[model samples]
Structure formats: structure tokens, C-alpha cells
Target chain A: MNLSRRDALAALAATGVVAGGSVALADDGTDGNVDPADGVPENVIGDDTVAILAAVGSVVYPDATTGIDPFVETYVSGRLSDDPDHRRGVVDAAAELDATARDWFDAPVTELDRSTCDRLLRELGVDAVDPDPEGSLSGRVRFYIVNELLYAFYSSPTGGRLVGIENPVGYPGGTESYRRASMGEETEHGRE
Target chain B: MAGSDRTPAPPADVCIVGAGPAGAIVAARLAEAGHDVVVLDAGPRYEPENRERQLDAHLRPGMEGPWGTGGERDAYTSSGERHYPLNAARVKGIGGSTLHWQAMVMRLHERDFEMDSRHGVGADWPVDYADLRPYYAAAERELGVAGADDNPFAPPREKPFPLPAFPPSHSDSIFAEACEALGLPTHSVPNARNSEPTDDASACVGYGTCKPVCPSGAKYTAERHVARAETAGARVVDRAPVQRLVHDETAVDAAVYATPDGEQHRQEARAVVLACGGVENVRLLLLSASDAYPDGLANSSGLVGRYFMDHCFAGVGGRIDRPTRQNHVGFNTTECHALYDGTDPLAGVKLEFLNYAGPSPAIDALHADEWGDDLLDSLRDSYGTHLAVGGLVEQFPDADNRITLDRSTTDDHGNPVPDVEWSVGPETRRAIERANEVQRAILEELDADIDWIVGPDETGPAYHHMGTTRMGTDPGSSVVAPDCRAHDLDNLWIAGSSVFPTGGGMNPTLTIAALSCRLADRLDRWL
Candidate 1:
């Protein structure tokens, strides 16, 4: 049977996800191993939620040289620990994606093949899996998934290299040296 | 240094509150003239070693420092018909707001002094621009201003700038071409930053982070003057916030301030100069109610906290067809003032090209759904090609847009916080609309694709606070007289933008410094 939006929400609630509240992991037998270097606390969000964000981020930022999985994991874990609204949105989106996968592929979203996951994401529009009807599903994904990835990429030294600026502000490239250009030869009536 | 340790306050020939640009200048001059001068600042002192960490903190998103504390968090409340984010715009260190200023120092137009005669709006200053011209020259020399000598837009001056104008950057080239095609005139902006290495400050190396903190001492901050004041035999006390003015019927007798440890002390002086910023100056005055004056200390005219004004600012940007390698450069290197003296019914506008080498974060926020190859391509196309232009529109002083004490909310020291009530008038709105139209036309001339244009209604803070305790010929309507002395008090003086009767289309720092120098000369004779 297909899972309705209400059924998906109820499944999330059953797993300890409350509306406008902190999300607790469902313990679906996945090890919640924490990497101290990643700067995210363990068991803040489910491994499944991190996997869902990774899948969406890979499709969204397909051109990234360093794959989006690690970025997604770090960003999601950090935001889930810091902001409650972020946790709620992420948990609900993961639940909705799992419910849709069950209805279509008869398995959890993280267990689906890459090709099937890509096709399913394409079929469901960016705004299709909105957990909160009042808010945009696409916007939630953009903020919780897409925006964080873009910020990480663009603010990096690699991203600055792509844009042709050396050591952009807010980065650790200390103290630059460059010659100031002149406004061309000044005409009698100012620069022509 | 007047050490932070709580000692009995000493008697002085001159006691200046707030060791910012104005207070530092006055204190330095008075001490040089052999007067016993002591200056007190409400914020802590910062050294060069603190610059790198503060710069990093400032550049990080959502980690900017608070007003008084160096990097500590603090908050103040504001409630009125209009809510102004007063905390974001103000700083309270010994060097004051100059610590975070971009240092675009241009003289006020001559017409800015004669607003009543020329525009039929606002009060005219008791002294005109010509009266201030010599002191302006002195201030330029002291602060190391760099500008082109032959620029036609500047007011007539007898002496040239001390340093040559900074060479334009890639963004300046782009802006110049567009301005030329549009029949607009462009000029090298006058800046307080050093173009060449001087003995005191280094030449600007284009770090592109001048607003929050200057990594190098390339741009002038008021702390240099505070250091000079200390070297010239003036004592400075930090983290000393003044609470009230102890006054008699004729003059201010002493300034009572509280230390960080909550101990109160009083510094007695023959003359007291209030050099705190525009909002805080008025708040201090309104808080100093006594038996002689029930309303406030300087409220005999009931105009202590009236006539607040700030420049109306609007931002517009577009993406150009050609890419330029102009991402990290000194900001405000070029400007166009052709629209400054227009025939339009609204006030004039000054358009400055914001030279940053990155895509607009506001635009990034809108494209949250974009990802993958599409995102990369879009970033490449928009990154170096994006150009932002901002317009600074003149706002006439309105008596209604004022700052009052919010008695319900108190600071950590239990004083009433300042509540700012400010709004743009119809003339400012019309001027902003016209400025946006001009910006779009310039972008079109450059064959650029328009990204977004924010109108006057969507304008943000310019942070040029002025006109609270205005100077005027009439004591009934203004707080200060021709020499910035309190109209009712014999020995109470004010320095800074708080005394500006009408704010011009340019930045007000140089003028504030000039007025402080002039006030020092006047006080030297009176003392």
C-alpha cells in the first residue's frame, strides 16, 4: 500500500520525531559511529537521515570533485545538533523519502540502487516531499541540503580558484600583494 | 595611561568623555597646549596583536563582535514606531567606530551648511563651510587623506591633499567605462587609508576587509590618535561608562562614571566635553535629570534628543558579459558624483561601486535549489562579473525622527537604553528611486544582465548617525551653539556628528575631526 503524507508523518512521530522539536534517532540497527574529526556529536540524527542527505546532495552537486557524501554528513550532523528546526525538517524528509521508496521500490531509501534513487528523485520534484505543508519541500531541501553544500564549496580555497580570486576573504590565505590598476589616461574632460 | 584600577578621580583642566575620533583629537590638542587633559572611554583597549583574531571573527558569518566588549556578546533593546538596529551600527571602543570604518573621507558640500537658504528645509549651521576650510586642511594632514587634486566635484580648497589618490582597481575600470558611456563623470574617491607607506601606517594591500576590521594598519583608525593623546601627556581611562553629568546652574562641575567592577567615581574639571556618539550623547543628557533641570541636564529647550538623521542607502547589482579579474581590491576606490547636484526635486545622490570579488550572498540565498554542474557554471559566470553599486541619498533632519530613553529596558549598568525612531521621508524615497534608475541604466550601458535591484523601501542602514544635538543660532531649537558648546551651560561642549545641523551627501568623519580641531582652538582661548 502507498504511504499517504499523514502516514509518513505518523511513521516519523512513531520514531520519536516531534513537530517543531528535537529529533531522536530511531535505532534501525545501523551503528552510529562518530568521527571526532568531523566535529559532529554521535547519535544526534539517524544514519539514515545522513544517508538521505548524501544521496540528494550528490545528485544536486554532481560536478563536485570531492563527492557530496562527507559534506552532507558533516553539515547535517552539525545543523541537527545546533538547530531544532533543521533536525525536524531533516528527520521528516528522511521519513517521507523512506515511505515513498517503500511504496515504489518495496525497500528503504538508503537500500535502493543509485540508478533507482536518481530516477526516483527526478520523478519526485524538488518540492514533492515537503513534510510541512506550510513550508516548501524544495526550500527545506535547499536550506538543509543544497545551501549548506554550496556554502561549503564556494567558501573553500578550491571554490575561490574556480572563480579566479586568490585567497578570498574569510579564508586562511594570509596577506596578499597586488599592484593597484589606474583608471586609463585622464582626458581633459576626465577619463574617456 | 589612566590605569583601569579604581583610584580616586583626579581633577583636570579638561575632562573629555568618550575617547573616539572627536575626543581623541580634542584631548591631543588640549594636552599639546599644556592643559591637564583626561579622556575616558566606555570600551576596552585593543592592540595590534588583537587585529588578526578580530578580523577572522568579523569575517565569519554570525560572529561579529558587540559594541563595547572587544569580542564579548552584548545586547540592547529598541522599541518605537520604527525599529532601527542600533547595536549593529555602533561600536564603543577607545578608537570608537573608526576601528571598523572603510575611511572614505570627503568634505561636506558648501550647500550642506546653508540648507535653510538653499533648500527651504532644515536649519543652517551657525558657521559656514569656508569658516571650516582651514581646519579641514589641518584634519586632512593629520589623518593622511589621499585624493586627486584636480577633481572638479570637490569644494574649493586653498591646499591640496597630503597624499596622491590610490590607483584605480579592475572594478574602477569597468565602472569608468560604463560611466563614460552614460555621460557621467567619475572621480577617484578621497580616502583616509594610506596609498603609500608612511611612518605610522602601512599602505593598503587590498585585504578587502575594511568594514569589520582592517588587518593591516593601512586604513586610519582613531586609536592612533588616542595613542598620540597619551603620548602628549593626556591620561586615558578605559571601560569607564559615564552615567550622569554633575552640574550647577551655570556649568557642568564633574562627570560621574561607573567602572566595569561597578564602582562609581567622579572626575572634576573646569570644562567637560561630551564626545560620545550621537545616540549615546542624547541618552546621557536625558538621564541627567536634577532639581535645577527636571527634564534633563541639557533639556532647557526640550530638544535634547531631537532631529536624528541617517543617510538613506540602496544597493543594486547586475552581471556583466565580460569577466574581469577584479575580486579583491580596496573598497570605494572610485565614485561618481554627477547626480550630486541635480535639478530634481529630491536630494542629490552619490553612487559608489562596491568592489568585492565574490557573488552576492543575497543572490546565493535565493538559488538554494540550484546544484551540480548548473550551480558550478552559474557561479563561474556570476563570480567575477558581478558588480554592485550603492547610492547614498541625503536625508533632511526631521524633528519627529528622534531617539528617546526606553525606561523599561536597562543596560547591565541599570541605565535606560536608547530607543531610536527613524524613517525616510518622501523626498528621500523619490531620490532613492531615481538613484536605482540611474544604476540600472549604467548596468545596461555595460551590456550586463540585471540580477536584482533593491529600492528605497528595501534600503539598509548607512550607519552615518547625525543631527541629534544639532548646532544652531537659536538656543530654543538646538542643543549646541556655534562652537558646539551646550546652549544653556557655560562649560559643557560636544564633539562629533551629534552637532551636525545638516548631513551632506558624503561621509562625515573628516568633518567631525575638523570640528573637533576647531573646538580645541576655541577651548584653548576660553580656558
Candidate 2:
């Protein structure tokens, strides 16, 4: 399926299909060897919340699922642990998604299949509206849910590579590296 | 609000208010020179270890600004023609705005000093570039400026920059091609960040977030000076916002400040230096109105808060077919000061080739309608293929665009907050229009599809405040004298950009530091 080995292993390990092997977590480009699930605090958000976010992430980043579950879990937990007001917004968005899934398909978002979850997000008008946190139901869902998943994926080292951004904004990639032209550039002439 | 029931600290040789660059340098120099120095800051001291977390807050959407601004304590009213975002760039902490600044340290041009003589507009500085030459060298050394002598338009310098300049970023090469085609000169920008490791701080590590936070301590912040001042036995009292000055006609006897515990204290000193930025410096002076000086202290001319000025910015962004490799470097490396020393009747313009231009991959990914493969495609297509050029345009000082005390609005300590009445004059608007023309020309030369253009109407301040409490030789027209001493008070001196009689389309921090060192030297000789 043209998936990287890291993505395959992470997809396997997420469903308990693999065990005991260390998964290469989202490389912040600082420390790449640590396991994602090792140091996450207890119940940062909710197990269902993480599961629903991972499902949304698979749709947003269908081809770049390297450590999808643990990465999404870590990202959601870290995000929820920030400001209390932001945490409440995310939590409320998760509840609304779950309620919508139950009314549409007689199941929670976490219980639905990947395609069904994708369909649920599309039916909720998340694609049409602007991503505003304080907007209507579709807008809030897009902001707190869809955009959150996208941010997690693109900011991660593995996912950043898929979109040609190796080191995202916050990560420091030594000053010497920036002097060179990016890959696929013709001229290398920015030196003194 | 009587202050007789408050604690009073022992007298200091020099009392410097506001622990920003100006105050910190003054405190460090005075304390190191064997004088008792005291620095009072209205904000908390941010720990260095929290920088990475602050960068996280900066990266995340919908979070408070990474500089720790906002809340009731930092409130101010903008009763101006334009609603100035006062808190948008200010940091009240010990490091001050330098904590979140871009770290450029270009000196004001030689022509900037003689505006009245050269252009027959604005007040001429009491001290010229030659007078500040030695101190500019000293400030560059003190701040660890990394720069080259590549800028031919720069004023005469006695010494080379302390550290070597950073090479142009990869994106700069793209702008260089377009600029070279159009006969525009681009030179290395002098930055206050170190290119190599120093005794205390690390070198530039390219964290790509120099604006809100520099995780590696390469970029200079005023806290470093504050630390040096403390090491030299200077007393730095944080969370102490000075209410008013207890002064007679000749001198300021003491500064009455409020603490976090709701207790007021009178800190007496032989000399008081108001190092609090341009806005607050004027605000504090106006707030200290007494029967002797009913208008305000150091305000006998009634020009304490007059001549408010700020640099208005203009920007243009577009997408080139080839990869411009934007956002790889956080700060700009190449800038054009070619138009600054020109005969343009409007105002001098300094163009910057911005490295961190275009939408980031994460932002582009979120805005994409198609999820999955299409989102990644959209990011790869747009992220690296964009370039932008922006610059600061000079603003003429106007008496109407001033800062007065908002008696209706009060900060946390029940003191009247600063009411800014700022407006962009026609000269500034024309200058910004010219800057936009040059920027658009460069983008058009690149054969790029222009996405947006921010002209004079859409422009805002570069957050470089100046001109209020302006310096002059005459006592009747200005607030401070040649040596930054208040015209009305012998012992009261004003520091920072508030003393700039005419700002010259440049980042004012280097000039601020230079003037600060000069002020310190003057105090050292006097004491």
C-alpha cells in the first residue's frame, strides 16, 4: 500500500496486533527513540476521545499514519493539558461528535468503522464551513477536531516529511542546515 | 491612595525604573562602577527553562501570546484615530520587549540626526551620529551584535561588528535574484543574536521562532543585563509598578511604587532614570502631576506627551513556481536600506526580505478542503513555493498623535492607564505607499503570482514606539535635554526610545542601547 514500515507497525500495534516492540513515536527531531505511550499522564482526556481523534486523523492524513494511535493520544493529551478553556472546547467538540454518530448510525464515533467515521465527518458539513472555534456546530467540529488532527500530523516529524517540511516551526534544526537550499532546488547560491 | 503608611527602602545612588534594555544597561553599568543601583520592574522574571513551553504556546492555535501579555494589569485605552494594539508587542517582564523582539540592531543613519537641517522637518537630535559613534560601538559589543561591513549605506563605524554576520538564508537567494535584476541593494542585517557561543549564551540554533521566543539563548534579552546587574550587587525589585514621582520644582526626591501585596513603597535615590518605554515614560510623567507642575512633571513646556511617533509597515507576498524555501530561517538576513538615504520628501523606507513568509505547512494543511492525499499535495504545492518582502516606513511626529492619561480607565493599581492618540500622518502614508511599490516591483520581477498586498491603508505599526518625551537642546519645546535629563528636573533623566526626537525607519533597539550606554557614562562621571 506504499506505506512506510513505521506506519505499518504503528497501525498493527494500535489494534493490539503487535506487542512488546518499541514504536517509533512522532519525531520532534529532538528525541526520536522514546516510546509515545511510556510517559503520558493518566487520563489526560479520555480513551474514547483519543480513539475518535485517531479515526479523524486517518482521514486527514490517510497515507501518513506513523505511530497514529500513540501520536494522536500524545497530541490530544498534551493539547487538553494546556489552558482550561481550550480543554473544555475540545472536550465539548468530542462529545458533540459522539452524539452525532449515535444519532446517525446507532454507535459512538470510536465504535464506527474508518469509512463510516469519514462519512460521518463529511455529513456534518465540516468541509464546507470555515474552521472557527466559537462558530456553529460544523465550524467548532472542524476547528477543535479536524484542524487539531491536521496540526498533530503536520507538526510531527514523520508527517512533516510527507509534506516536504522536515522540521516544523517550533523544532530547532541547527543554523547550518538553513544555509543550504531545500531538496529539489536548482541553485545553491545563497552563501557569502 | 495616600502613601505615608508604606515601607520605604534605603536610598540608592541611582534608581532606574523599568528593567528593559535601557534600565538594565544603566543598572549594570552603575552597579559595576561602584554605585548602589536599584531597578524596579512592573512584571515577573520569566524563567529560561520555560522558553520551550512558551514556544509551544506560540505554535498552538488560539492560545494567549507567547510573551505573556493581557489581563487587567496590562490594560490601556487607544482613544486615537487608529486603534493601536498597545499590548500586541509589549512584554512587561524583566526582559521587556526584547524577550519577544526580532533582534535586529541596525543603527540610525547619519542623516537621521539632522532631520531639521537636511529635510527642514522634525526636530534635530541634540546629539548627532558622531557624538554617539563610540557608544554605538560599545552597545554593539555589549549586545554581541553579529554583522558585517557589507552595508555601504551605513554610517561611519570605528570598529567592525563584535561577531560575524549570519549568511543569507536560502530564501534570500530567491529575493536577491529578483532584487539584483531590479537594481536594489541587499545587505546583511545586524542582529543582536550571537553567531557563535559566548561566555554566557548559546549561538543561533535556528529554532524558527525568534519573534515570540528564542529557545536557545543566542538572541539578546535585557534579563541578561539584569542578571549582570544583580551579580554586581544591584537590587532588582520585580512586580513593583511605580505610581508617581515625589518631586519639587528642581528634582525628583523619590519614586512611589506599588507591590503585589497591595503595599506602596517610596524608593528614594540621588538620581532617577525613567527607562520605561516611550509610552509608559510619558504616561508616568503625566501621572505625576502636582500643584508645582499641574500639567505633569518635566512638563513645564506642556510637551511631555507630545510628538508621538511609530514606524508604519508595508508588506507584499506572492507565490513563485519554484521552491522559495520559506520559514526555514526565523529572522531576516538581507535588508535594503538603499532608499533610506534618498531625497524622498515623504519619509525614508527600509525594505526587509522576510524569510518567514507564506503560510506554514500545518496552517495550509488545516485550511485545505480535501483531506488525506490531497491535503498533503496542497501543502507541498504551497508551503515552499511562496516568498514575501516587507519593510518599515518612517513616520513624522505630530503633536496631536500623543499619549495622555485615560482618567476614565485605570490599571490594576488604580492608576490611570495610558490613553494613546496615535495617527498615521499623510507623509507616513505616502512613504508606506512607496515601500509597497518597491515591494510589489520585487515580487513582480520574480515572475510570481501576487497573492496579497498590504498597502498604507492595511499597514500597522512595527511596534517601535518613539518621539514622545522627545530630546532637544531648547527647554521650551522639548521634554528632555541633550543628555536625556528632564528639562524641568535636574535629577530626573529619561531613557529608551522616548528621547528619540525623530525616528529614522530603523529598528530602534540598537539606538536605544547606544543612548543607554551614553546615559550611563554621563551618570558615572556625575556620580
Off by over 4 Å in 2: A1-53, A64-67, A70-110, A119-149, A184-192, B1-8, B366-371
Interface RMSD of each: 9.4, 5.4
Expressed as tens digits, the lDDT of each residue in B1-527 for candidate 2 is: 01222355589888889999999999999899999988888887788876865775676554456776877888899988899999985899888999999999999999999988988877789999999999999999889999999998999887899999999988788888888998898999999998999997989877778997888889999988999998998888888889999999898999999987888889999999999899899888998999999999999988888888898888899988876667765888999988898876348799999888887775566667778877777777777778889999898779998989988988888888888898888888888888888899999998989999888788889998898899998899998988989889889998999999999999999999999999998988887
Indicate which candidate wins on TM-score: 2
The candidate that wins on DockQ is 2
Question: In candidate 2, residue A75 scores what lDDT?
Answer: 55
How far is B148's C-alpha from truth in model 1 (Å)? 1.2
Scored by CA lDDT, what does every candidate get?
0.72, 0.80
Give candidate 2's TM-score.
0.86
* DockQ of all predictions against the true structure, Cα-based: 0.11, 0.32
